[model samples]
Target chain A: MSGKVTNGAGGSGDGGDGSEGTPELDAAFFARWMTAAADAVAREADRLTELDSAIGDSDHGGNMRRGFEAVREELGEEVPATPGAVLMTAGRKLVSTVGGASGPLYGTLLRRAGKALGSAERVSREELAGALRTGIDAVAQLGGAVAGDKTMLDALFPAVEALADSGGKDFEAARTAAEQGAEETVPLQARKGRASYLGERSIGHQDPGATSAALLVAALAEADTAVEPEGDADGTGSAQGGSGGSE
Target chain B: MVEAHGGKRVGIVLVSHSKEVADSTARLAAGLAGVPDALVAGAGGLPDGSLGTSEELIVEAARRMDEGAGVALLADLGSAVLTVKTLLAEGDELPEPARLVDAPLIEGAVAAVVTAAGGGDLDTVAAAAEEAYTYRKL
Candidate 1:
């Protein structure tokens, strides 16, 4: 689901200049990204719960829905002054509203990433990528999980890695990487989270957390495409040209 | 009713996914400590009374238990622990110097309540709760 740039105002730099190699996303962009993520979560809540029912406590969908709805309401109440503030506020809301491991894990990711972003009015793609890596690391440390543990990190680590390596301009590539990573979890035996309690039964079920993570990354790509339709001709072109090989 | 032991002791908090469990455990711990007036509170369930932990409830319980000394929190199950961890990481919502004691829920609550009733400080109360992890049930 693409989130149209309804409020492209505020923040220090207006990143739509065609001369710049990469656009500097502002607070509004991050807000729009979160809102888009919330919308996606709401749309796929049932699927998430279904996936969780297979291995988890079957509350992932409801937990994520409640948390993201709170984020949307908080963002609607008052858009923060900077990207970091927006992320931090959203993280706090998630931590308080969502009552599960996902709550703290996702909350920590956003909070740590927001803290890394500091109070910058605008952030470059590279800065955003690095900050996301920092956030993912925080989630890993909080959850005591790694890539092959069949958790959200499975999707998140690959997506951030792809984004960082692409000089932080290839949100589409990151999205695809995240989707592939999520799919790869279907064959993995979980070593972390509640799913690990199921032991061998955890196999053959796609991780709900990784699936939602993919949706989040997909929303990011959608936000990027929506923000500047013509900024990344290659991005938009490849996106429209279908999911072809990006090597 | 147990009298105040000359000073406020470390507050004890019990957290669980079910409100009933937390409430009863709190009652049982206080009763076992022989101090019916010990500073202890129970937090559990979601706002809708569902079977899930709530940070709002946990913070509220912590605030109620905080008596200028500090609070020692014990949680049951997955999200209960995670929710407490989240609050601890935030560090600004709960009372100053709150801690999440790692121990068996009922045993830890009993140990913490007894120590607090005896006017134990934060560290001592926490250590007492942790020591319950190795207590012999036989």
Candidate 2:
């Protein structure tokens, strides 16, 4: 509650900004997030590999699958109540269970985001942004990559900056910025880590991490729509929200 | 005298070098772990005129894990690792959290199977495989 921005116990909706958001992200949302993450990776596993093969060892997709499956399995065991803890747990598990650079990087995103949420049952757009900021920092720490590196950070940093500049009141705007940032990674020259080794070769091809980063942003934006009063406003109920808690 | 323990709740999987051995081994292991909810999958093994690929067996085992310790994948060598890698490749996205434990073929399988059935973690199954590493005089 302290870390996440929320609407309190009242039934106030956060709109799309995630500020004025739910005081508590439900379990259903957590499940949806996991499914979204898995689906995102599954949809682009081959594409991810194609991107990685050009500069790295060419096993990004395989590596992602191992982590995602583990996350899905872990979720079945226990779903953390808060949005942040989920990401933290998922991130840690991926780091410990999966091998290679991507594991630590992706794991950081979830872990830092979870930490930002603290123990709050709900999170505000600001809180989510803060958590992601922490996550982006962790990735920088773990991978030591900066902006325009043709790595995940290239996309992640811009997204974070955009989110922060918006003051956490506009999830849609934040989402759009993240998407655009991810796309911009394609033209940049890799400056660090494995991708940098390829030098000019890394150009043109989209960074797999960046693509996945965009998917995560898109998933968050989608979560808001699914939970909003108009979208699935009916009583049938559905698994809505981000996997931030289950990570 | 193989035994499968606590496997009933988690639903474990069995992978042998041969179908007959796989079935027979399941029977022996069942006694060791008591009656388990473990799932047995061995469609004939390499060098045994069996019908399935070791990769398929591992994939089956992984699927079983997803169905519920996650999964403990035990194989009778030959193409076990290769198949395991192959299955892992197939899971280029959404891979299950199963471990490929190298269990001894003849005598060791019984112990591995029993331990795996006991709701053992991938680590436990792997340890069992290592413990069951003794070569029989046969």
Candidate 3:
């Protein structure tokens, strides 16, 4: 699950001097990332609701779709100048438009990351990684969920860990980690959120929050691949890169 | 038909997943208290009248019921509580004061409304709501 950094095509040019040559992710990347997230959520809305119906309310899918649609609409109205501004606005929209515990939880994640990014027009991979850690931590704090709680944290915590462990150079790795973490939730009883009311009955059902969270990381990977296609001619850089490091 | 509450007393907001639940609960609590002066509003369900809480509705309720004294919020179930907390966290500027009380819905609403009718302050009315938590039917 962790290893040495292998410079992939996406990360090749940086001198490893650690700062001056670091690639700066721009607002365009953030916009594409959010759009990808909305698309993924829309595509999987019914599945998410089905998952929730097993252990919780059957509205997770609809709620997430509505929230992300609101985010897209807000972004369409006026594009923010910086990544932080874009994320902050998106977070605000989610909190206002989404009506469940997930709204505030996901809202805090993006808003905290946006605040950590500050007013910077762009951010280094490392900077983004740190900011994401803060964002996920805010989610944990707000929801009172830890990795084993069968909540979104089950997916989010591992994904963040993968991002940091990879020095933020591999979005694919994080996405895979998130997906795997979400899958792992199928066997665990929920210890938090509305699902906790189900007790042992919650086991065997995949957590809807964790499933959606995985889609978010997968969207991040897709956006990363799209923005930096130099070393990713096959469009499969992160997966290969992640595998290489573990070897 | 009953006369509306006419004084600057603590307000009450009932939050529930069902519109019928919130509205009926508010009516029952208001009736039990018989206080025409206490402002009570219901924030429940989606705009389409589905079974779910809405932050917009809650904020609107808080805005309308607030009178300079304060507002006590009573919520049913998990998502309802989360929605109310999230709304308050977003920094909406409600007139006067507001507090989210952790207590049983129907019983707490009755206690809270009665306490507010007597001109209780924010904390006092909230305490009255909390007191319902200890009420037992043995």
Candidate 4:
């Protein structure tokens, strides 16, 4: 009952699910999540670059920091009206700023996902899960790589699958899944991206893209917990309020 | 002016992680093609003068080269290719009919310029560039 705090306007009714009591997340929630991700990327930039130096280009850290910083700046200047708008804007910024493969890859992920969300003012957890799948699939197609490739998909696939299967309520589980997935990349000989050039030498090095992907998922969980401290225990949040009651 | 067969010549762009590489390739290709008026541009390097391809630069170059005949882009390496692909995927801001040609940089640029100077359309020019892979030096 505490999760029912519908205050959002414009019932997009895009969720289609019959679960009317599910909480809905707005643009502000998505902005908060992106900001949290920016902070996390900034804090771990050096670690990420170090990991990349072991097997791939040594620019992943700097590129990610620059890209997220642009995202943070753009969002701060003008917060978009809807969650989809915010993500789309952020994705464009990343694409234009980051001067590496990560830019386009990450840009496609957010842009496609945002496009899937459409103009819904508020999206339920289930809706968000579906949108994320659309985004992740775009990533795989763009990169021409699949799971076990020691690429970002190593972490992203598991995180999205876990999030979707849990009806998008288990951010903690998604975060844990992402972290484990990244860790598992340490022993994998890369089959895609720059690391693939190293052949067997790429083994024993954790994939920097996977590491950053884990941080992004962890940031999502952190953003949710920061908004609803009480929801941390039951895996629900106050930010995910509105729109669900209208439909 | 290089005469087009029946329409305007297709534009060519060389995208590389290094400015020097892109510019030099453009110069070599244009010089060898003997078409001073050909629309060939070089877009390379980040805004900070680093060794990376800039999406902004690619978009700018493509726009500058676009003359309603479409633009063909040849990228040097990983990030350069990705950047061009990203622009193609976004599709709105970039000029209409821009394509990424998957061919070796120097040879492809030369071939594309030669073909374009001969008044080839976008598809013909791109095919010529990609056909560089089959050129035999031996």
Best by lDDT: 4
CA-based DockQ, model 2? 0.02
In TM-score terms, which candidate is top? 4
Q: Which ten residues in a row have the lowest lDDT in candidate 4 chain A?
A: A1-10
Segments in model 1 whose C-alpha atoms lie over 4 Å from true places:
A1-23, A228-247, B1-6
Candidate 1 clashing pairs?
none
Compose the digit string of candidate 3's lDDT tens values, residues A1-247: 2453544657445435234432457677888888899999999999999998889889999999999999998888887987888888888788767777788778888888988888776677777888899999988876667878999998998888889876787799999999999999999989998899899999999999999999999999998877765643333323321222110
Model 2: per-residue lDDT, tens digit, A132-176?
888788677655567777777766776676677665555566667
Against the native complex, each candidate's DockQ, computed on alpha carbons, is: 0.62, 0.02, 0.42, 0.76
Model 1 residue A116 distance off true place after TM-score fit, in angstroms: 0.7
DockQ-sorted candidate list, best first: 4, 1, 3, 2
List model 4 lDDT by residue over B26-104, tens digit each.
9999999998734798998897788888988888888888878889999987789887887898757778788999899
Model 2 alpha-carbon drift over 4 Å, by segment:
A1-31, A228-247, B1-138
User: What is residue B103's positional error in candidate 3, in angstroms?
Assistant: 1.1
Q: Which of candidates 3 and 4 reaches a greater DockQ?
A: 4
TM-score of 1: 0.87
Expressed as tens digits, the lDDT of each residue in B32-97 for candidate 1 is: 898874488889888788878888899998998888888999999877887788788764999988
True contacts kept of 3: 0.46
Q: Weakest 10 consecutive residues, lDDT, candidate 3 chain A?
A: A238-247
- The per-model lDDT (C-alpha) reads 0.85, 0.61, 0.82, 0.86
lDDT string, candidate 4, A145-212, tens digits: 99899999989988988887576778898899899989999899899888999999999999999999
